[model samples]
Target: MSSKELTDKLVAAIKSGKYDAIICNYPNGDMVGHTGVYEAAVKACEAVDECIGRVVEAIKEVDGQLLITADHGNAEMMIDPETGGVHTAHTSLPVPLIYVGNKAISLKEGGKLSDLAPTMLALSDLDIPADMSGQVLYS
Candidate 1:
């Protein structure tokens, strides 16, 4: 879908007031970056930024929480040159985790992906199951 359409739908959902939180992955940075199109990647990042801004606005209207993160990093920082039409394997570089909400959580530098689930659960006032390996980031 076009950016405008996507934005409209997101705004509509936010206004619906059915959910308490918003979890979104603006895939442009990851997808466009994989093709080695630097310009397109930049544009995609801009688009994602705009989408994020809109989402944040919606969240603000309801005094709700917004969790913005990525499962992995494929854009912004390219560690190596693309070769012969083949993109490089995923980097060991850490992904970003940003939380904007009422709950308090402190994320230390070099945190691992495993820490996310527990942190989120804690934020929602939910218990982290004993079987989970991650600790609550703040608690």
Candidate 2:
């Protein structure tokens, strides 16, 4: 779907009030960036930024929290100087994570991807599963 269509759908979903939280990973950045279309990849990133802005507004309307993160680096990044191209394989590079809302859900120092599940569960007053590798990040 076009970016406009996707954004519209996301806005509608947020306004529906059927869900308490939102989690999404738009594939445009990864897919377009992998194709080596630098211009298209940049456009995709811009689209995602606009869409996310709208989502955040909706979340604010409902007094909800948002945890935005990625599993690994794909877009919003550049080719490693050593590699000279987008790394065809995953690396240990740190990904970006943004927490928006109350201070209660803020991350403690040195949080990692593993901390996400536990933090979400804790925010909802749910017990963290024993098997989960993440620990609740206390701010």
Best by lDDT: 2
Clashing pairs in 2: none
**Candidate 1 residue-wise lDDT at 118:** 83
- The residue-level lDDT of candidate 2 at 94 comes to 74
Estimate candidate 1's alpha-carbon lDDT, on a 0 to 1 scale.
0.71
lDDT of 2 by residue, 1-139 (tens): 8766877887787788887666767777777756666677788889888888987887788777777776766655546668687643444567667777765554676678889989988877789989999988766
Highest-scoring model, TM-score: 2
lDDT of 2 at 20: 69
TM-score of each: 0.81, 0.82
How many clashing pairs in candidate 2? 0
